[model samples]
Target: MNQENRAGQWSRARQVASPNQDARPHGEVSLLLLHAISLPPGQFSGDAIEALFTNRLDPNEHPFFAEIDHLRVSAHLLIRRDGECIQFVDSDQRAWHAGRSYWWDSALNAWRSKLNDFSVGIELEGDDCTPFTKAQYTSLVDAVGWLMARYPALTPQRITSHAKVAPLRKTDPGPAFDWAYFRQRLSQAAFKQ
Candidate 1:
């Protein structure tokens, strides 16, 4: 099918699906996993990355998405460079973004064994080396607002970066992400919207 056809298959008011999802586990979605991505690492949105997730990436087209052209992965939502939000998984289902991770509950001194079990994963369209756009941040905050309102289980404290869990394996929602700006923006937007 064409890109428009595939994209239209899961278009909703707040998200678009990927036909790459399944049911979420039986439990509350308490955690929010933060992530970042770009088909060629620094490049912005394009049909190539979307095609990659839909198992349609061309191996010889670009060296960036070429290496992992065979891998299959999707997140619950993808915030584009312009702040557009795309959904690949439902809020009630698990998105296979996080693989082996933990959340800090320092009081308990033990890792939360099931971080991904009941979490909503959001992937931003950017990499560790790139600076995310202001529009992206606003759009991300808007999406987060929508999610928190939809799922009461999610709180500010529950939102976390992928790097927090897989320190050695990943570095997303990286240093350029500006956590403080997002937090403040989220807090402000939450009150107004």
Candidate 2:
């Protein structure tokens, strides 16, 4: 891992940064939001999704993007189907992918936390029913390990699927993502460390 290059935080090639980001709130990087996306909902293997994050999506280029043309969003990282990891936002920064989301925090009532401010968002290339490839899982584990190593405050409990955080509005890293398998992977990684 190239410690100097934050881009090396993941195991794949790095892409252009998204402008839709800001500083983490209260310097609290305590949560990890897992998500999934495909350019045309179910299609894969295209640069359209990457372009969208960088604010360069050509609406007319694809009919599926037409509806979301006016919307702007971004995540900290995206793990392609083949497990190619791309970083759109830095760990120290906040990504704008999560909107109107909340997570449990015993100290606060109706705790509303800005996704960008309190958590790191990672988008996988898949749909609701699609099973994530083994490579993607391996890559996700590695990426999360890197982040946890860099930020001592991050932990497995902090990691959660998009559905868990925004149950009413979003669902990704879906049901097929087998939380137990990944949780075991994380525990093994932590043990190894």
Candidate 3:
């Protein structure tokens, strides 16, 4: 597995620094939230996702873009449809992926809020209707394996979907995301839960 440098960047991914990030609170990174997105609703393979994350999205390009152009949001990484990994925020920093979300921290025996303070977000280039590509899954497994090795607090159980964390406001990495298959692959990659 490739190691991230002191600056918190993973050696394997293409770095695309995002302004929509900040230092992680307490330098704590324990949760992994999976998300889904596709520009123009279901369309894929364009610069739109990158544009949005980088705060360079032109509002006039699409109606949807106009609606969300003002929102400042980004994930730590985006695993593209063909398995290409793009790192927008460093692995050790906090990306603004989870907004007003909550998680049950079993270690603390309490419910944790402000999930962005302690979570890493990985967005898959997909939608609720389309099945994620095999390539995407393979890359995701590799990235997750690398993340698990770096952060001891990031156990398999700590990884979850965005929908679970922000039920009222978000539903991503949705039905099209096959959790069973993903877990199977993670295990196959020797990532113990």
- Return the top candidate by TM-score: 3
TM-score for predicted model 2 compared with the true structure: 0.90
* Candidate 2: worst-modelled 10 consecutive residues by lDDT: 4-13
Model 2, residue pairs in steric clash = none
State TM-scores per candidate.
Answer: 0.85, 0.90, 0.96
Candidate 2 lDDT at 22 equals: 79
Q: How close is candidate 1 to the true structure, as a TM-score?
A: 0.85
User: Lowest-lDDT window of 10 residues in candidate 3?
Assistant: 1-10
lDDT of each: 0.76, 0.81, 0.92
- Candidate 3 scores a C-alpha RMSD against the true structure in Å of 1.9
lDDT of each residue in 74-116, candidate 2, tens digit only: 9888999998888988777888977888888644445766667
Alpha carbon deviation, residue 149, candidate 1 (Å): 1.0
Tens-digit lDDT track of model 3 for 1-193? 3345566777778999999998877998899999999997999999999999999999999999999999899999999999999999998889999999989898999999999999999999999999999999999998998888788999889999999988998889999999999999999898344
Candidate numbers, best TM-score first, in rank order:
3, 2, 1
Better of 1 and 2 by lDDT: 2
Q: Per model, state how many residue pairs clash.
A: 2, 0, 0
- Top-down lDDT ranking: 3, 2, 1
